[model samples]
Structures are given as structure tokens and as C-alpha cells.
Target: MTDVAFDAHDGIGAGGTADVRRRMRDELRQWAILAVGSLAIAGVFAFMLAVSRLPGIERVLPWPTGFFAKGLVIHVVFSLVVWFLTTFALLASIATLNATEEGPRLASLGATGAHLVALAFPFLLAPAFFNDSVASLNNYVPVIVHRSYYLGLLLFGLGIALPAVRLLANVGARRLQDFGHLALAMSAGAVIYIIALTCIALALSLSWGSEPGRTFHEHLFWGGGHVLQFLYALLMLTGWFVLLRSSLGETSFDADVFRLAIVLLAAFTLPAVFFYKVFEPFSPLQTEAFRRLQFVVALPSLIIAVGGLSGVLAARRRGPLPWHDPGFLALVLSPIVFGAGGIMGLMITGSDTRTPAHYHGTIAGVNLALMGLFLVHCLPALGRSVPPSRTVRAQILLFGFGQLVACLGLFWAGGYGAPRKMPAGAAHLVDGAVIGMYLHGVGALFAVIGGVLFVSTVARALLRQQPAAPGINSAAGSLTQIKGRRGGR
Candidate 1:
């Protein structure tokens, strides 16, 4: 049952494990299709918001000027909330499929559809924003609370929850070693996220009458949003570990320590949930409680990250690294970006430009890690050839550079007291502020390019090939064969 034991016996060629790999591979391809579409929308909106900051661009914009806020809200909702959650949800579903041969195929498909529905809403109902519809810029889940938004949200919530439930149920049903510890840990994180969603729903329902205006929605989002950070941190940490394993051929961290870290992350939430329910819904005490809890919840990720880094260093001492592998490049770069985000976070002093800088940095790092995993593992498993090593390396570097410049600009602007999320024209006033804003706008433009590269890479890989030749039960098989022939450890 321990992770070490599972790893020792686990091999792609192992007969029992092969079945799981096939199912997981099939599910991942399906999820990848959904992910690509979601990511494209997210990229476009991200590019738009960046372009909006530049002079001469707003006049040529297709939508009305008021649409800026609406567009920002849409971008935040789909890019930040939907896209990330959908990707993590798919990861958990794949883990479940690995655990159980007879996975919840129908429900998994439904979850994908629901996520697509949520993704589609911003485009489909964008006009609603112009027609007297509200755009509540809640911290985490910003969107209009109209019927269409509500319906999409409801389905999205269900989409996230159903797969989690199936995964957790399977985890309980199976033996410990049967489902690898990493998979189980991932599943546990999914459960925590679903519970956080439930808490948000409860808060929204209870506060509608008691609290008015943004307070109601803020109260609704506060605790759940706080908890979701832990979820994101956990998933990002998992992605880091996965990337390390894929790129380095082995991870340096102790399996027991990693699993325990995951357990502690899940355990810490018990108090968070209790604190939310026991305290008044909209009290400052509640807000402070969740804020402090986020700080506490984030500790494990740091520990794991350090452990992973140590492992990488030790591996490098053994031999020269496979620098040509894009996955390897990402594994090295992502943590640096994430750490920059953390440092930017520590510089917060009553909400300046640093706030967005912190988040975008961290989120970009997470995306990079996940993208690396896809290129190294998912594409190969799905019987798709990874792009040229040079191309993949270029994409990774472009993303990292873009994000670094963007965050640097924001931090520089924040130091000058430039307010965060100001209108596009506001930052253009002071010369120093203009430089900062221009840096962000230009960097974001490149970040969008990097994102586009990812989408294009995935599309090319998939489109170039058929749905894997028959007799290949899982995508893992293809990867196993390739690695085997290469004689890699």
C-alpha cells in the first residue's frame, strides 16, 4: 500500500497496470480536446485584456468600451476559474480511470460537456453584459449571476463534483496499492475542491437575504475561494512532481513525505470549513480566518517544492541532464516562476499592482508545469509525436519570459503606487507608470503567443495522427514502447 511499494511494482508493461493505462490514456485524449478548446478561449480573452491596455488599440476594438469590465470578468471566470478547474478535474478523472477499469465513462463525458457549457457561456452570453446584465467581479469566480451564468455554473459544479465522487468511491473500493498514492492524493484534493464548492453554494444561499450588493457575493466566494487556493496549490505541486518524474526519470522526494504532505493539506481544511460555518457568514473575522488559513495551507507546497528541487540537484550530480527534452526544461523553469509569484505575494500592502502580479506569476507557473506534463506524457501516451525539441523548448522559454516580464512590470508599477486593475488609460499618465503598463501589455502579448503555441502544438500532435492504432489499450503503451526502445530508465 505505500507509495514506494506501488512504484516498485508499477510498470507500463505490467499486465494489470496496462489496462489502467489504456483507459487513462483514452480519457486523457478526450479531456485534452476539451482542454484545448477551453484554453483557446482563455488565451483570446487574455490577449484582448492585454491589448486593451495599449494606446490606439481601444479605438479599434470591436466591442463597446464598457465591455472592458465585462471582458475582464469573462476572462477571469473562464481563464482563471473554469480552465484550471476543468484541467484538474480531468486529471482526477484519469486517476480514477486508472484505479478502476470500469470507470464512470458516461459521467466523465457529462462532466466534459458541462465544462464546455461553462466555457461557451462567455462567448454565447457576452452580449448579455451589454444589455443591463451584471458583472460581479468576485475574487475567484467572477461572472454575471444571470440564468445563463447560473446554469453554466451549476453544470460546471456538477461536472467537477461527479468525477470526484466516482474517483473517491473507487479509491475506497480498491486496495491501497491498487491505486497509486499519487493518484489517491490527487483524488483527495479533488474532494476538497468539491467540498469548497459546496461551502460557496451554502454561503451564497444563506447570504442572499442577509447581505446586499457585492458583500453577498463576496461572502459567498470568500471562504470557498480561499480553500480553492489550497486545491490549486496541491494540484500544482502534483503537476510539479509528475513533471519531475517524467523528465528526470525519477523523483528525489520521499514518497511517504509527499503523501503525508497531501494528507496534511486535506486535514487542514476541516478547521477551515468549521470556521466558516461557526463564524458569522460575512464577518471580518471570517475573512481574516480564511486569509490566514490560505497562508497555512500553502506551507506544504513549499516543503514539497524544496524536496523536489533537492531531488533534481541530486540527480544532476549523478549525470548530465537531458536538456534537450522540453519536459525537462519546463520542470526546471516552472518553480522559478512560481517562486517569483510567491515573493511578489509577500510584497502586498493593501492592494497595488502587485496583487495581479503575484497571481499571474503563480498561475502561469502552474500552467507551464501542466503543459510540460502534456507534452512529455500525454502526447506520447495518446500516440501523438511530440513536436521538435527545439520548438517545444522555444515555447516554454517564451512563456516563462513573457510571464517574468509581466510580473516584473507589475511589481515595478506597484512600487510606484499604481493601482491594480485601473482603467486602460489610467496607467498612461505618469512616465514611470507608462513604462510599467507597457511592459505588462507587451509581455502579456507574448504570453498569449506562448499559450497559442501550446494549443497549436497539441492540435498538431493530435491532428497529425489517427486515434492510435488498434490493440493499443492505452496511451501509456505508446510512451512505454518508446522509452523502452530508447532504453531510458
Candidate 2:
């Protein structure tokens, strides 16, 4: 089977024409730009974070007292929250392209929302420079405790949420029939995203007290943050499907089984709202309930990942693997990194660097999947082809291995009692901890280089004006030719 044939069977390209596909690509362009741009901006903050953590760099470059904490808060919001959600919006937009009646309205609303997010993003950074702004380094969506920062966060959430609502409202049996399992997966993710937002609202309403310090903000974001993990998990699964299909020409798993897993993942989130009602928002019970809710993601993730691995193995049986293909490389590495993270999560014994190590592994897995999707499925679908190149391949491998090394380094340091979120100079490390930090620093450097390569490549592709290549403008034909050339070899 070819990608074109698989897409037709899967309903993504069932009735899409060149003109229709072009419009769809145009609609997705803004969200893609927003997603990439968020990473670029996040990289800036990430660099600051690395600098702040340097052993003696802080004294040399005198920043404000709370600058490290504030920078971290901004980094988490942009790198994790904004980047992930904007990409989700883009995926949601792709799923709804077949909605003839509702498509146009939704596209307009989504584009407008993307613009709103871009406009509001700067506000998130503005507070980092101000002395008065307090950094609430909460898990999930961290915030700076200032009105300006709050406004920016609110607008950013609203921008994504508005289109999400429209996307959910437009979903129906017809759309499902036309769009197939991919649409179902995206819709499931959107539903979970909305549920996450609702969890945040419920937490705020239930705990409107005069609590002070990090405790309040931590409890505020705890429930919502845990729920948001399901959203990211769902999206990662979706990426796996796209990557497997585009690379292998077919998925190894049964369609019915995949749909069942997705439904289960989404259905489990429905009961999360009651956690707020049943227990006090700030109580340990409520926090534990939300924490346990994350376990639900495990089974489904394993099911899909195992199925994906099965597909890769089956492909290997037929012929040599497409190591040269960036999608194939990412598909192979994503699970290894994520599974390592899951293992590390089980090893976490205290509030040490192990927790960051665990999350870094898992989030890197998600990042790898999305990057592969963009390089293969997304760019081609948008009539912007990304031919397999050494640089692109290196970017994928460098980011994957760099993150893995970084996570392992963190895990090693945490095992030696290195504290989380502390600058190296402040950690007062010796012996093993120092060695681990050294490895962590080196891995992070390589990862940053990889990230820069990705941003530059994608930005150049998005900005360059060129006519659509033959067979590229039609959604069904987008990856057919490219996959044929690469996979046939």
C-alpha cells in the first residue's frame, strides 16, 4: 500500500482536491508558524535558564534576585504549554478540513486565535524583567504572579480554547466517517484539552482563598496539569500513527483496536471533574487523585506503542529499514526515550532532579514525534516538501540522543542527591553529582544545537514562496511520491 492509498482508506484524503488541499494547508500555515515560533522564543528562555544555572556565571552576569525562577516560569509556559497546544490546534484544524459547512468558519476562527496568541505571547516575557513580578514555578502551566502576566496567560489559553470549542462542536458522525481514526484521535485530544481547562477553572473556583507562596500556585495547576498530560499522550499517539503510516505504508495494528484505545483514553478523562467536587481542591486526596489519573495514560500508550513497534518489526522483515528517513528515525527513537522516562518515573524517590529527568524523557519523546510529523506528513501536506537531507536527519538524532543523555545525567545526579531546579553553583555538588552535571551540560548543548537546526529548517520552509510540486497539492497525493522514492530504495 502507498500513502495515497492508505490516506484514502483512512478518510483523510477521501475527497480532497488540489484546491481544497491548498486551502487546508493555508489554514494550517498560521498554527504551524505559531508552533515553530513558540519554540524559537522558548529557546531564548532556555538559554537564559542554562546560563543562570552555570556554576559561576550568575555572579559574572548580575541578574535580579528572582531572575532564574522567573525565567524558568516563562520557559515552561512557552516551551511546554504554548508550543504543544498550538500544534494541537494545527492537528485539530487538519482533522476538520473535510467539514464543508463548518470548515470555513472554524478555519477563520482558528487563524484569528493564532494571531491573538502571537500578540499576547510577549506579555508573558515582559514580567521577567520587572522586579515586582513574582514567579510561581507551578507544575504544568507556571505563572508569574502579576496582572500583566496573568492577562497574557489568559489570552493565550483563550486563543487556543476558542478554536478547540469550535472544533469539538463541529465533530459528528459524518465528520468521523469522512476523516476516520486520525480525526477521532485528534477529537479525543481536544476533548481532553477542554477537560484540562475545566479542571483548572474548577480548581480556581474551589480554592479562592488567601493562601500565599508556591503552595497555592502548585495546588492551582496540579489537577489541570495532570489532566493535560493525557492530552499530550493522545497527540503523541496520533503522531505515532502518522509516522508509521507514512513510513511503512500501513499500520500494524487493527483499526478497531486503535479506535477502542483512543476512546478509552478520552472516556477516562470524563470523571476527572468529580475529583474537585469530591475532595477539597488543596487537599492531599485531591492532588493524589489527579496524580493517579495520569496512570490511565499508561495502558493506551503501551498499546499504541507496542503496535507501532510491531509495525516497524514487520517492515524490517520485508526489507531493510529506512534509517535515512527522518520519520523512520524518530519513530524508532521516540519510544525508547519515552519508555526510559517511564522507568525513571518509577525510580523517583524525592524532589530531586529525577523528576525533571523523567519528564524530560517523556516530553522529548513527544517532541520527537511532533518533529517527525512536521518534517514528513505536515510539510508535504502543506505543499512544502522536505527532502531527506543529512542536516534534517542529524537534527532528529542529535535531539533524541542529546535528550536521552541529558535525562540520564540528571537521573545519575539525582541518585547522588542533587536537588531539582537549583543552579549548579548553588547545589554545592561534589564527586558523582559534579560528574553527572558535566554530562547533563554537554547533552544539553547538543540538544540546543539540534533545536536550532529544526527551527531554522522549518522557518525557511514556511517562509519561502514557491509553486506547489506535482502531486503535492492534493492531500491524498502529499506524501505518496515522497514516500515512494524514499521507501522504495
Candidate 3:
């Protein structure tokens, strides 16, 4: 493998003239604000969710019959669906920053899409307040079985899909390799997202039953939902690169190896469309195929993670680590959390708290990476640097630690046969399970605090008006300066 010199300005394929870069940076900032705002809004619903789950608190709160379920649906859509997709749009915008012909046009479209998502967001939450709303806590993208809720979801999907399609069309195949690993990963993730949308469309047309309830929605989102996980995983991996680059001053893995991992991740997703062709949408075989696909596709991530660990160790031997840097903390914690989730996934024997445990761990891992990326890399690159603060570092640690403890608590309670998505009072848990639930509740409280700190800190930085300095055009340039300063000290 050859060593490719890192170009600070063009890193992640952000090649453009000064004016174009400025315009792209402005657009990227909006996407960043949109992404962070989505998480902030999600936090509101998350608090209600945690309150409805804790033991004694549930008895005191006057949640309606379907409130918890409805809130869960909204929380997942905003935090998981909206947050992840909006961040992807930001990244895709970076990759296409150099497309002089389509860049301006796409920028307009992307901004419009971002606004559309924001407009549709309230509708997703509106159903939870209505007494007539029905929550279908389906596997992937859960839904409220109302026309308004459905309309909100449809508009949200369209908002993401429009820019994603434009991104895919703009990224030429011949230029893929030149875009570097991060850009390639972002582009590949776009492809996977588009494919997931396609799978959902096919599932809608080919679904076996006419029932308009949970089972129907479950199968409706099953295949596409499974596929969407790959996109999330890919995005998490892309974030790992950004976090690593910011923390270590360079990527730990070989450039070609990084590219290969991205290609394989995207290439594997192409065959997922065929599963719909071979097996019925509701078939056990189809479900199993999607389940197995996750395991199979995870190999690339395993390779990257192993390589990253080795790199981190080598860097550690050379000098002191960046313990003060939140990016470093996030990079270190992400894999630990994600790997734990993967192990817990293997331990699943039934539909218990273990399922939520697995997902929470994995999702938190991804969230941590994106959080760090946004604060430490994206903000600084766009000329909005979050000043060095204990609050930022504390936020990362608190969230990571809280999530880990929460996952452990859930796993422990699951061992005692505690049901998922039920309040402690309603779960009919054993004494042992109750203890674990208490732990879970406490951990979630701390995690929410940490998440709140992150949101406020980033929100403040985003709100500030900062003049563009030299090298603000390149994401890697800001990271490079951080690395140089750390090395000099």
C-alpha cells in the first residue's frame, strides 16, 4: 500500500475555489445547526420517556394510555432517524463541495430539504399529544398510525432522499478514489441510504398482508430498516475517521485499507435488494437474511476497528495521549460501547430489555462519535471553534459512562426476563429486575444531563458569528493545526 499525502484543503474531497468553499461552508453550517437542533428536540421526548420508565416516577406522572408508546416513536425518529440523516447530509455536502456545476444548485436543494425536515418535525410530535394517535412501535423506523403522522414521515423521507439522490448523481465514479476515505465513506453511505429507501418502496408494493396495524408496519419497515442500520454503521465508521484524525493528527490505518472497507460496506448492500426478489417480504427466510446480512457486513468495521486500535497504541507509545480532547475520548469510547452492543446482541434469547440494551449501546456509540465530530471538527472547520472547556469533556464522559451503565442494567434486567418498552410498574419484573431497572433509570438520568450539556454547548457555538480565518476552507486544516499545537507543547 502507498502512503497518500494528506491535503488539508482537499481532505475529504472538499476541493473548490475560495468563493465556492465559502458558500459550501455556509450551507454546511446550516446542516450542522439542523442536525444539532434535531438532537436537542429529541432530548425533550427522551426525558419524558425516561420518566415514564423509572419505577416510582411512572406512578406519579399522568401519562395517557398511549403516551409512552407515542413518545417513543417520536424520540426514535428525531434522535435516530432525523439526527443521523441530517448529519449525513452535512457530510454529503462536504463531498460535493467541489462540484462547481451542481454545487450551488444542490446547496439550494439541500437547504430546502433541511427546512422541510424541520417543518415536518413538529407533525411527528403532534400525534403524541392527540388522544386518537396510535403508536406502532415497529422495529426500525417506528410510526404513529395516523394520516398526519404518516404524512410527516413521508415528507421527512423525501427531504433526506432529494439531497441524497443529488449527492449520488454528483459524485462521479471515476473521481471516487480521489475523494479519499472519508469522502468515499460518506458517498457510500449515501448510496446505502438510497438503497434502503428503495427497499422500503419495494416492500410497500410487495407486502403480503392488507392489515393496517403493527404487524403490517413491522414487515413494511423490516427489510428497509435492517438495511438502514448499515448506513448508520457506515456513518459511525466515517465519524471514527474524523474523530481519529482530529485526535491523532492523522488516521491510524492505511489509506487503501480504509477505502477497501468503505467499498466493501457499500458493495455488500447492493445484494440486499435481491433478498426482496428471492423471498416474500413477510417470510422468515427474508427476515433471517437481513439479520445475517448485518453480521456479514460487520466484518469491514471489525477490520477498521482493529487497525485503529493498533494505530492508537503505536501513537501512545510515541508520546502523551490527548486525554483533554473530547474527540480522543469519543474515539476511545465508541468502539468499546459498540463492541459491547455486538456481544450483547449475540446473547439475545427473547424479546426483553436485552433488545433495547443492544440497540442503545450501538446507537449511543454512534451518537458519541457524531457529537465529538460536530464539536471538535465540524465546528472548528467552519470557523466556529468550541472553546476548551471542562463542560465539553465532562459531557462526553458522562454520556459514555451513563450509556454503558444503562446498557449493563438493561442486560442484567433482561436476564431476569424483564419486558422491554414497558414502565417499571407495568413490566411485572422480578425483584432482581427491579434493581436493574433502578440502575437503568439512574444511568439514563445522567446520560440525559450529559446530552443536554452537549446540546447547549454546541448550540451556543453554532449561534456565535465567527469571521472566517485562513485555512477555514478545509476540514483537515483545522485538525492539522490542533495536531501541530499539541505536538509543539
Candidate 4:
């Protein structure tokens, strides 16, 4: 006699799915906490390098950019490396909780290791001219190519591309649908940008004998730089989609429109962002073409943003929206800040203020949203449940608002003659504006406090071995199914 046993429906159950997702969320919290620490260090370095003078920062630095650019390059070396690590941890943690994609995860892990090594190249190249005698330009200024830096860039580019290839392939040819397509576009765009950067770096290393390697490198760099910026922006949008669906439990407004926007971003955006690379480096004629492309990069983002905002409002169809949920808070803050960034981008051509305005807004605002979403979205899954109370509610409010304002103030100040790192002296600003310095410092301070508190809370939850609330289970999962890792995915 065979005993009849009930199945939990294709190996999934309400509790099991919940259990899996919750565990994944917990891992996100820890991953974010580690990221915060690295970002904080970068921040500290930024304030110090920006506010104070450094040792022999001139003769050795081969670039001629702004203080912010210089400081930021340092920050990127530190921050990107950390981000690479943080990204891997996130992948591992995600795998631990999901346990559904072992082969891809392993490939991603290997690719990440290569990526980290690639990230080290910039660091190796910096000491050549980071001294006071080397150079003093803005942050994001292109450095003259160093051999180590070029090689490092090659490694870095390969690292990013290889993982992307594996992950895209792993999702398999059959699974390419709505989300997969978005991911593919994003990855492809990223590849383009990465290639552009490598070309720029290569150009840097070459001698410009009456020409900068026939201008291909410059155009490539432009393409790469713009695309890098786009990659971040695109990922943030995806993050928004994730927050909305998972956190808010609602379908996005005009989902097809958003997807189309992504496609347009890939198509129209490429030529616009990379036009500079196609020109004569010093030809006066090419200026207009370059400027026009800048407009291209900024316009579509602004247009799409308007559509997204309208769609969001349409979806809500009312005011007095919930301000307490972390996910909602991100939706509130991210788009608004990015919209403001779009406005800044529209204001001028090649002005220092105009250039960095959008950059700061996009980078800082997107990061802001990502952080807030992780809070409300992932904490409970990790067993460190945030109590729904006036305090947490207030934390959510002050945290998001304070950060938005702080990032804006900082970026605006940077745009408004608040030069980047070690600004000769605040007293010697573009118009001798004392107010600029004060505003920048204040903004940085506020942002720091907000970031610290945010991380502390997540860290507390991450350290907890048991669920924060009573009804949670602590079952373990595989980190990688192919290995002896605890939670195999």
C-alpha cells in the first residue's frame, strides 16, 4: 500500500518563498552595511583632500583637472574597489538566500575577482602624479595615461564584461523577456562605456604626436564616460522597479513605456554620448557637435523622467501618500532628485557648474535611493525587523529629506563656484564666496550623520543570528550549489 503524500506545488510554498526572500533581504542589509563603511572612508578622504592641502600634489600628478576631480579619483579608487567587494558580497548573499542559480553565481564570482584586480590599476597609476607638483584639476578630470593604469583598466573592463556575458548567457536564451531585456540593454550599454574608458586610458598612455591618437581614444573616452554615468542611472532605475514591485506590492505605472525608455536609451543615447570621440580633438568646428551630444545624453533622461513622474502620480491618483514605508520614501526621493538633475543638465553647455551638477545629482541621488530601499526592503528579511512606530517613521522622514537636501546643497555648491578639493582657499573661490564653503561643509556633515545612522541600524540587524520577530524561521540555504559554501544558489 502506497501512502499518499501532498506536494507543496512544484517545490514552492507560501512559507518557503517568503522564507527565501526574507533571507535574501537580510543578506542585502549586511552587504549594504559593509558598503557604507567603505563609502564613509572615501567620504572622509574627500573632506580632507578637498578642504586641506596635500603633500606635493602638483609635479607628480599628470592631469590638469579640478580639486573635486582629483579627490574624486582617489575616492573612486577606494570606493570602486569597495563597491566591487560589496557587489560580490551582495551576489553571494543573494545566492545564499535564493539558492537557485549556482552556475551563474560562480561565474559571476570569478568575474568579480577579475574585476577587483582590474580596479587596482588606477590606484597603482595615481602615485605617479598625485603630488602637489603633478596637477590640480577638478574631480573626474582625465589623467594622462600611465602604463599600469592602462593595464589595470584593461583588466577592469574585461572583468565587467566577462561577468556580464556569463550572467546574460546564464539567464539563458529562452528566459529573455521583459526584465531580461532591460538587463541586457543595461549590460550592453555598460560594455560600450567600459570599452570607451579603455580606449581613453590607452590614449592617455600614447604619445600625442600632433594628435591624440587620431581622436578615437577621446571619442571612446567620451562614450565611455557618458555611458558609465548612464550605467549608474540605469541601474538606479532598475532598483526603483525592484523597490516598487517587491516593496510596494504594485505594478509599475506604464511598465511598457519604461521598458521602451530603456531601449531608447540604448539606441539614441549611444551616438549622443559618444559624439565627442568622433571629432577632431582641438577643432573649433567640433565644439558644437560635442555640445549637441551632451544635450542628447541629458534630454532623453529628462524626458523619460517626466514620463515616469507623470506615470507615478497617475498611479497614485491622490496626495497624502504614505511617507512611512522605506520603499515609498525612495520613490519619493530618487525620482525627484534625478528630475532636478535633469533640470541642471538643461541649463548650460560645458560650464563647470553645469557639468558637475548633473553628475552629483545622479550619483548622490541614485545612491540615496538605493540605501533607503535597502532599509525598508531588506531589513525584515534578515530577521532585524524595523518596528512600525513614530520613531522609525520619523527616521525615515528626516533621513530621506535631510539626505536629499544635503546632496543637493553639496552638488549645487560645487556647481556654484565651490571648486573641488583643496580650493586654493574658500576665500579665493570663483567670486570669493565664503557662503559656498560653508554650505558645502554643512551639507557634507548632514549627509554623513544620515549615512551613519542608516548603516548602524542595518548592521545591528545583520549581526542578529535569529529572526527579529517571533514568527520567523532560521533555516539555512546553500551559498553556491556547486561548492561547500553554506548557502548554495
Task: Name the best candidate (by lDDT).
Answer: 2
Model 4: per-residue Cα lDDT at residue 251: 36
**Reference-based TM-score, model 4:** 0.66
Ranking by lDDT: 2, 3, 1, 4
Which regions of candidate 3 fall more than 4 Å away from where they truly are?
A: 1-23, 50-65, 98-105, 467-476, 479-489
User: In candidate 4, what are the lDDT values of residues 34-133, reduced to their tens digit?
Assistant: 5555566566656656444555655665334444544555566545444433443443333222323221334334335344643654454464443331
Q: For candidate 2, write residues 1-489 as lDDT tens digits.
A: 234221223223234465554555566788889999989988988888777777788779887669889988887887888889999888777666533332344446776777788878888889998888888877887888888887897888888886676666666555343445555777788788888888888877776775645877787788888888988888788777777776786545455556667888999899888898888767888888888889889999888888888888888899988888898888888888998999999989999899999999999999999998888877766667678899999999999999999999999999999999777677588689888888988898888888899989999999898664433234546533322111221
The top-ranked prediction according to TM-score is 2
Candidate 4 residue 78 C-alpha distance from true site, Å: 4.6
lDDT of each: 0.67, 0.77, 0.76, 0.47
* Candidate 1 lDDT over residue span 1-489, tens digit each: 001111222222234344544554555666666666677766677667667667777577655546666677777776667767767766666565444434343434534544555565554346434655566776877766456666667666776676677667666765544446546567768768876987787787777666344666788788888888878877777767666665565445565566667878887876766775788866888788888887775677877888888888888899988677777778777888888998899889867888989988988888788787677765664567575467778888888888989998888777777888777656445677668878987887787778788889987786665744432343444333212111122
lDDT of 2: 0.77
C-alpha displacement of 32 in model 4, angstroms? Answer: 5.6
**TM-scores of all models?**
0.86, 0.90, 0.89, 0.66
Q: How should the candidates be ordered by TM-score, best one leading?
A: 2, 3, 1, 4
TM-score of 3: 0.89
Error of 4 at 463 (Å): 6.2
Output the worst ten-in-a-row residue range by lDDT, candidate 3. Answer: 480-489
Residue-level error in angstroms, candidate 1, position 26: 5.5
Residue runs of model 2 more than 4 Å from their true location after superposition: 1-24, 51-65, 99-105, 173-179, 209-212, 468-476, 479-489
lDDT for model 3: 0.76
Q: Give residue 304's lDDT in candidate 4 (0 to 100).
A: 52
Better of 1 and 3 by lDDT: 3
